[model samples]
Target: MSTSSNRQMKLAAYVMAGPVSGHHGGWRYPSAQHDILDVRFYQNIGRLLEDGKFDMMFVPDIQALPRRLGDSLASQLTHGALGALRLDPMLVLTAIAASTQRLGVAATISTSYFAPFHIARSLATLDHLSAGRAAWNIVTSFQDAEARNFGLKEQLSRDERYDRADEFVEVACKLWDSWHDDALMWDRATPQFADPSRVAPIDHHGRWFDVEGPLNVSRPPQGRPVFVQAGASERGKDFAAKWAEVIFVTHSSLASAQAFYQDIKERARSFGRDPDQVNVLLGMVPVVGETESIAKDKQALLDDLCDPEAGLSTLSYQLDVDLSPFPQDQVLPDLEVGGVQGHYREVAELTRKQNLSLREIGKRYGVGPLRDFNGTGGEVAGRMQEWFDARACDGFMVQMPYLPGGIEDFVRLVVPELQTRKVFRADYTGTTLREHLGLDRPAH
Candidate 1:
């Protein structure tokens, strides 16, 4: 492994904490968390990730159930397929904050649906409560179920949604920045707890929203907790380049990932931002064990649990198209979806490359391996080092196929191998998440 002394790879624990995280039947796996409703399980996972020297533990939330192909909620629950995705990530994240000293806990909240003020206040509160170890995963929701909940008849056009999101972010940034670092005077004699000059109103009037600030909360610890974006479409990339400090990405191959990494960094530079400041983390699944054979078997067991029916149902909502209406053997239809432009392109490209049928695509959905790995701990770590050396990504969002077991295996096995190579941290050297991720804290 080409280990650079200055450039250590960042790693994060990615979890959904719904019914199944990555695998369709992951919750059914013997070692996976069957009683996921327990609060202790969530806390343990966060603490474990901190023990492993992870940058952050992210809870990717969905405001609504994954409804597809007219699949009833009962059917989904019965099959343990996307049973429920609406748990408030903020509540869980706060609990995680209390337990772990260094682990950054993040929540996925939709920019498309939420009022900018709400996002600003809640995330700021988290940053304060966590003592700066907080992150916000910005997502433009792709679910029609989410749109319905927001009282929208249908999703906005792609251009419109991005436009609104751009302004949404603008509003949020204004709110976050409204309270200056020195705003909290805390002078008992003067009885002026805050300096009015330092705290000013950002009367922002934009295309999507109108907001008058000074936020109720003071400046967040990291000055608008580490901004994370997970969009990869052309417009999404532009948005990320402008504001995202960390980007979560999905690419089918290393070359594509590398291409994406280079492009996004270049885009950031074009926007007058330091390219190196933008960390691109690829989403990947690592099925690991002590030996290669053991690892492959572990992966196979997860793959075998693929339920095509549930997969198809899940795909419909993901692709934002009703795949249930299409014939099983028919070539996957090209739908002009208004959501998740990047994912839509990925799926569209998949069909275009191989002329895959709906059934095949559904199977592929059940098996979502974005730059997956199956090998011994050393081998898995080796692959990761190669990708890092190749400049495919700054690090990885290690997507767990099943709970606790997959995490325990990776931390126990792969982390030691990585530490031996001196490519990953053995113990946290920084207190805040930005420091751990090698990012400079935003100046006041």
Candidate 2:
């Protein structure tokens, strides 16, 4: 293997505490704690990532619970834990920030439901509170359960949501820029607070939203909390190309990942943006143990704990079609269902490509690799390296298979191996998330 330090590659971890991720049943594990409402658990996870020298921990949030119809709590209890039972991502980030230093905290807050001013202040405060170590995962949630709670009779279509998000982001950026570099002047003797000249109103008026004037807070330490966007639809890619500093994506194969990566970078270039400005990150789940065999054994323990029926229910919501309607051995129909985008298509594509049976698909649902690649230490690291070498991803956005245990093992086992191989870093040399990701901090 050629020994060259790949300084540009970045890595981040995702945390969703419960039985499993999108799959419904994994949380019932004795080791798994469904009560993610606990602040201490999240705080510990934050501490662990910092110790592991990981770039950041991104917490994905949904505005509402979507699966009450497909799978009741009984089904949810079996397969995975939904967002309804978890701590508000913002609160969790605050808890995590208080307990650690250096680890960047990023939370998903939807653009569809929130106003530009509200979103701007909340994220800016987090950036200031975390001392510039903050990021925002810009998402327009897909589930309709989110819409009802926000008082909408129906969910906005994906394209409309993206349109709103584009404007939301633009307004947010203008608001962040309202306060210039030296807006605050706390001269002890003089006591003239802020320079009024530096403060300017954005005066934004768009079709989706209208906001007037400067944000209540000043510009964050990193200028704007590192802009991260996650959506894999065509409209999503365009939005990401225009505004995203980091793009979170899902792909079943290396070819798919590379294709998506190349397309997005090309799109970014067409917009007169540096391709390097958009970091492509593949979402993956890692199951680790002392050895590959041990890891398999550990995964078996998790699998044994899984409820296949619950897994199916969760899959139903993700695929947005009731799997129970189809026979166990019947092939899935190639229906043109359009509401949900991104990961929904990804899951459907994987099932069709692999020709997986209903039972087979359910079994693998919340098991080991929830979204992307899954394996033991050596195998996982090898696959990760393959993606990196193929230019499929700039890094991996690791989603935990369980609570602290899932993330704990990867940090302890796989990280050391990857570091020794020189494929991953041994220490974090920078302070802010942008610095850690090797992106230049914007000056605005």
lDDT of each structure? 0.81, 0.75
Candidate 1 residue spans exceeding 4 A from truth:
1-5, 352-356
lDDT of model number 2? 0.75
In candidate 1, list every pair of residues with a backbone clash: none
List candidate 2 stretches off by more than 4 Å: 1-5, 17-26, 33-35, 68-73, 77-80, 368-376
Candidate 2 per-residue lDDT over residues 319-380, each given as its tens digit? 45556767766555665544446656665676788887767666666563343345666777
- Error (Å) of candidate 2 at residue 276 is 1.1
Q: Provide the clashing-pair count of each candidate structure.
A: 0, 8
TM-score of each: 0.94, 0.92
Residue by residue across 1-444, what tens digits does model 1's lDDT show? 223666788998887777766677677777887667777888999988988989999888876776666655643655566535546789989999999899998898888888999999999999999999989888887767778877888777666777888888889888989999889988999899999999988999877898998899999988878888988668889989998888998776788788898899899999999888898898877788888888888777887777676667776777676677789898877687755666666677778877888787766666674635668889889999999888999888898778888889889988999899888888989888888887777776
TM-score between model 2 and native? 0.92
- lDDT for 4 in candidate 2 is 34
